[model samples]
Target: MTDTTPADELRTAAQTLLDLADDTAEDMATNDYWRSAVVEPKHWFHNGIDNAVGGPAGKLAGLMSPRFARMLAIYFRDEAGRGQDFDTRAVTLARVMNGGQP
Candidate 1:
């Protein structure tokens, strides 16, 4: 039996996009493309409005170089958030997903 909780599954899902950047040279979400190349479409946010915005942003983020992705991941994992500018949610999320790994 699996000991994973719902939160664990969500973190795992979030890690999916982040992990696509790993071991990659240029692209991040390679699996999102290949896995759904001919079947279901790949999407981060559904709904016409949200998809309109997040769709492009997600695609752009996914195109980030592996180095950039790694650095961002590292930043989110280690650096604490300043003022109300960057919230700690992402930081905490990254820390959770990375499990304190750098």
Candidate 2:
């Protein structure tokens, strides 16, 4: 029997979402609806799926792995959760991003 943890499951699910998004990737240049929507990102955000980061973005690749997801969530969820400030949180997040290699 294989042992798969919840993080592993979430990772798989994230991958599936990325794959599905790729499968249905539409060229914004040729997509009038999408093009018009992005023209006023904040306005469209009030409608649905506010996934934009800076302005108009998609496919959250940073959540590619469970570890990455956890690290990011920790930093964003609450800096006070661990009694760490912004700099500390940034350091912690950076360490995880480096994969603890060195």
Candidate 3:
């Protein structure tokens, strides 16, 4: 039996999705996947960062010192890794919220 509440699980899963997006952006930057004749990696990376952490999360992440933010980005990127699909997670989360098993 799990002691965790539904709200707790939902919050954890949302954070995981955000972290996954952040990590994917970092990977794109690190692996030079954003480099191409038509695209600049720096612009692509920052755009991703903005999209990933936008709104309230963006405000909080922006409040961190430059070094701390960079470190945290790297940490999240490494810890979360890649290949997870946020779209699928969204669907699952929706199901769970509706009292259905994902």
lDDT of 3: 0.50
Weakest lDDT window of 10 consecutive positions for candidate 2: 41-50
Each model's lDDT? 0.46, 0.39, 0.50
Among all candidates shown, the one with the greatest TM-score: 3
Clashing pairs in 1: none
- What residue runs in model 2 are displaced by over 4 Å at the alpha carbon? 21-29, 37-102
- Weakest 10 consecutive residues of candidate 1 by summed lDDT: 40-49
Model 2, 39-88: lDDT tens digits are 46333322223344333432343233334444444444343233323344
Error of 2 at 35 (Å): 2.6
Count of backbone clashes, every candidate in sequence: 0, 0, 0
User: How well does model 1 score by local distance difference test?
Assistant: 0.46
**Candidate 1 residue lDDT tens string, 49-79:** 2433567775565445445556665555333
Models ranked on TM-score: 3, 1, 2
Assess the local accuracy of residue 37 in candidate 1 as a C-alpha lDDT between 0 and 100.
37
Better structure of 2 and 3 per TM-score? 3
TM-score of every candidate relative to the true structure: 0.29, 0.29, 0.37
* Number of the top lDDT candidate: 3
